[model samples]
Structures are given as C-alpha cells and as structure tokens.
Target: MLAQTALAGATSFRPLRFSDDGTFQISIFKDLHFGKSKDLVSYNNDRNSITVLNTILNAESPDLVVLNGDLITGENGFLENATVYIDQIIGPLVDRGLTWASMYGNHDHQYNLSAEALLEREQSYANARTQRMVSGHDAGVSNYYLPVYGSDGSSDPKLLLWFFDSRGGNYFRELDKSGNIVPQPNWYNKTIPLLAFVHIPTNASLAAQTVVGIDANSKPGINNNVPLAQQGQGWCEDGTNSNDCAYGGQDIPFIKALVKTPGVLGVFSGHDHGNTWCYKWDSELQLPGVGGGNGLNLCFGQHSGYGGYGSWIRGSRQLLLSEEALGRGELDTWIRLESGDVVGSVSLNGTYGEDLYPATPNDMTHS
Candidate 1:
C-alpha cells in the first residue's frame, strides 16, 4: 500500500515495500565515465575503480551488478571510446563469467554518433543482444524497459528488476531523433515485479513550489522530466561545471505515474551524489532510514563518482540487502566503500510508502 502528506517548508516522497521472500543481491554504482578525457581517467582512478570493482565481484558475488550509467566518457564523440572502455577495461570480467547489467547515460549519447556508427559499436560486443539502444525511435521515445528476473536464468526467479534508459538512453540526440533519454511505453505497461533505476532525481514536490525547505535555494534553470537540467536547477558557483542537469527535474512526475501503475516495489536512482539519505517519501515529510530500523519490502539506491572507486560520498547512507534479510522483513541494504568494507549502514524504516502528490500543477508534477 502507498501513503502521503505535506508540510509548509518540506519536500516529501512516497515510500515503497519490497518483498522479503527471495534472496536477491545486487551491486549498483554509476559515473565511471571511462574514455571521457585523458585528464579524467588517470591511472590512479582507473586502478582504484578496477580494485573496487574486483572486490565487489569477489566479496558480494552479488546475483547482479548494475552500472547505473556514464560507464564511459564520449566527450570527443567517438563511439570507439565507449567500446574501448567497456571492452578493454570491463569486458575482461565477461570472459570470467560475471552476470552484470548496465544502462545508458547522457554522456554516452552526447557524442552525436550516427545510427550506423552506433551499430558498429554494438557489434563489437559479443553479447550485444543483451544491450538495448534507443537511437532511432520516433519522437518522445527513447528505449524500452528490460526486465531482470533473479540470478537463475532457467530456474526459480528471485527478483524483478526494471532498468529504465533515462536521458532517452543517450545524450542529446538530433532533433529528428528522440533526444537523449528513454523509458518508452509503447504498448501498455507490463505487469511485472520491479525495482526501477533512473539516472536522476524527480524534483522538489509540488507543495515545495511556494516553500523553500532546508537550505533550498531557487537557482535559475530549466529542468527535464528526468534528471536533466534544461536551464539549470540552481545558481552556479564561480567557475563550476554547469553543463549537467543540476537536479532530477521530472523525476517526481515519473515516479508518481510509475507507482500508480502498481507492481513497482521500489525505485532506485543515481545522478545525485551529494544527497544520499534513505527516507520515507510521504505527504508530510521524507523520513530517513527504514520505518523503525526494522522495515522491509522496499529500498532506494544511489552513489555516483565516489571521488575514487571503493569509496562512497561523505554523509551518504550505505546499505546491504539480501534475500534472507528480506524474508525476515529485512532488506540488507548497506553502504560501503569501494574497497568492499561496510562503512555505515541504514536500517529499513518500514513506514508505509506513498507519493505525496500526484499530477499537481507544479514543476516535478504533471511532467
């Protein structure tokens, strides 16, 4: 069931419940941005990322590993950079037989590659079938959703995972092409158990329209329905990187529409690295952590660019959720370093989850 509330100077989110009957383990991270610029990919960072990734693969041996987005940097617009990064840097793991899943980020598509060029890049991968692209879709469409069912392929299923290609699954596409962003719903929504992944945060709830809660400053910017920034979320600092979406503009609307559909156990996202607290999104306020430190049936995700691999942002909540934990009405969602050490973890706050507002005439709503 869902819950809600609102306040004068506060922004809230709807909470969710994840099933506790299955043993599902997952590893999620984003913004590796390999091949972006020589300066960005120093040996130290690369080696650090490699160490952390290797540790995660060994320690958790999770049923699944999800690289949220921005796996490679395509600044100069070379599809080969993406290819080389994954193939040489990460593809080695594929040969070692590690089951992993990935999503496309804005950087990957920002390169402005032609469809033919993209096809060639896809061809480089042996399991290209597993990867789905949203290049040649009609207007207002990016990529379709892919359902992930547990660890066992031909046996019992454990969890239902939904991977959305936000940013239209590519960076800014040509006008004729659907811009960078995806999560297309051509046919009706399918009925499947799901924990969704989007690249951005929605936005401050509609009620926040009049209220500027907690250090909230009104910056000048245009926001996309997803996490992309149209103008800019807030004011930029002197000489700051203003090229990216400052906030998850339309994330709020997307969540409301998705949750209303049912079968959406929870939604996990990356994009916002600074704010990483587990809170219950409701009509009143967003409560941090699980309901009583003993909640279950739901969880949210995030953490991008840890300054280095094997590390998490300061003030971020670390978690570890497993099937056994969920069965006990506990999701082993833990926060840890890239080195695979459990730094600090949050207990599930099983408060009933709900969307604070649905289609309210505000920024995050009615996108």
Candidate 2:
C-alpha cells in the first residue's frame, strides 16, 4: 500500500489536447528580443512586444504556444530581470490556461545567465513543457520531446513535438597551463512541424537554401560566404566558421534525425531575425550520395520581438493540424502578423485541393 501510494502521488505530465474537431492548433513566436533596459525606447519596445504577443494569442486561440528563441535580450547584463521578461511573454498563456514551451537563443545568455538558468526559470510556470530532464549530451538544456496525444486521451501519440537548444556563441574561458585556452566542445545540434525551436542555424540550414523553392527575401548587408541571395533576408550563421555554435562540428546526425522521424510535417527555428522562409531538405541534401528521400520542412519563424535589430514587420507562425489532414499525413501552417495579415503558408504533406491548403497563402513544398 505504501509503495502504491507513492506511485500514485507522483506528478504526471498532462498530455496535449486537440480541439473538438480532432485538430490541433499551435502558435509559434520567435525572436521576441524582449528587454527591460531603462530607457524610453527600450521600455516602449518591450511594451509593443507584449501587446503583439497578447494580440496574437487572442486572435488565434491556439492549443499550444511556442516561444521559439531569442525570447529575451541580455545585453543589459542584469540576470534578475530575466524572470521579468519571461513573465511578460508568458502572461497571455497563463491567463488563457494554455500550455506552452520555449527554447534559448544566441543572445539569451548575454547578461551572464546560462541557458540552464533560463530554463530553470521557465519551468516554474504550471503550463510550460520545460521539464528539466537531462538530454545526456553536451547540448545543455532545452532538449526534450513532447507527445501530442489524441483528444480521446489515448496513450498513443498522434504527433511528436521536439525542442533543441542551438546555444549562444561560445564565451571565452580562462587559458590552460600550456599557455592555451582550449574551448569546450560544442554539444547540442538538432528540431519540426513535426516543430523545433533553436537559436542558431546549422550547416544543413545553409545547404537547404540552395534547394528550397520559396522566393526568400534578400538582405545585401550580410557578409556570409553563402552570397546575398542565399542569405534569405538575414545572415545564415552556422557552426562552420564559428566554433561555439554546435558540438561535433556540423551535427549532421541531428539533422538526419529530423529527416528520419515519421509524421514530422515541419521544423521551425528562430535565429536569423530577418529570415522567414520554409523549404524541404532531403537526406540527399545533407549527404550527397544518399539520393532523394522524404525530407523535413525547414522554416524560420518571423521576428516577433521589438528588442532585436530588424526593419521587417514582426509576426508569429501558426500551424493548424486537422484530423483529416493528419489522417492524410498533411498539416497546414502560415505566418500571421501582428496586424492579422497572413503572409505565407503551406501544406506539410503536399496533398493539396482540400480546404486546408488554400492557394492564396503560400505552400512550402510538396514531398
């Protein structure tokens, strides 16, 4: 009886729910870039971000909310203020009794707070999916999977949700005895609308640009080697030139997992604030000799926070998964601006002609 009581008393994770129509809705906001700097402009920007977040939350009324990355700016060097930013961003979700999740970005650790510390703060929220389960790798925290079960409360999951920490650039540590400071090895590299949230893009992200069909916006200011057109409106900074980006260099295995996972409709990230393009990446693209195979949809969430640097209009990405679409191995997603305009959209599985994939909103790619 004592042992049974102990087991029964343990807390359990609440499985994600779907709407009455057997469809699930998710609103993903990235690069919130929220900061609490003491200045008129900074204060106003933070307020605007909060208002936009609330507006999107009320407008879409999604089943789940994902605050992708760069959720907060840390240039102020104030660690205590971190919680303040999280509270402001998560307030809408709490009020509506909605479940949400988050990931850290490259700038998130600017104020000396590590990603692990940030995750600890987010775990305090009752509805957050940030359980502190160790990922057993050097990738740090923000590595876990959430299963979206059927609305009937079945044990079998209908869809899988993945979150990865692309980590901020490496900070310099003290030198070793041999007059050299060997940096720690990069560990985490990995994501999907089958969806992921990461702060930095991987080398695979850079390679995907060459193959995607989307007419991505151009940014001439970027200085990366991939050329201005391939930059996709923002710089595609991967781990190739930067040693602090990810572990095991390019993290090809991580990217391959996203391709191998079944029922994965897309993978979303938020690092390049100005880039918001979605395209397909097959195994052949990752490994030239592999040939063509089912690929994963790679997408970048629109910049939603005012704290970051970017001249583009800010918005969030919304994904709709209907039971019929899921049965047909398809999902629908689009970018919804704070002004309530649908920028671009696509059908995940490529099977068009249904009410899900309207011609007006953009379609990512058919696999």
TM-score of 1: 0.59
Stretches off by above 4 angstroms in model 2 are: 1-13, 36-38, 135-137, 171-195, 211-213, 216-249, 283-293, 351-367
Worst ten in a row by lDDT for model 2? 227-236
Q: Write candidate 1's Cα lDDT for 330-360 as tens digits.
A: 3435544444455324344343233121211
lDDT of 2 by residue, 148-220 (tens): 8887778887777777766553332334689553333332434344656555665456666545333433211
Q: If scored against the real structure, what TM-score would every candidate get?
A: 0.59, 0.77
The regions of model 1 sitting more than 4 angstroms off are 1-22, 39-43, 112-130, 133-158, 168-193, 204-253, 285-330, 349-367
Model 2 TM-score? 0.77
Which whole-number lDDT from 0 to 100 does residue 121 have in model 2? 63
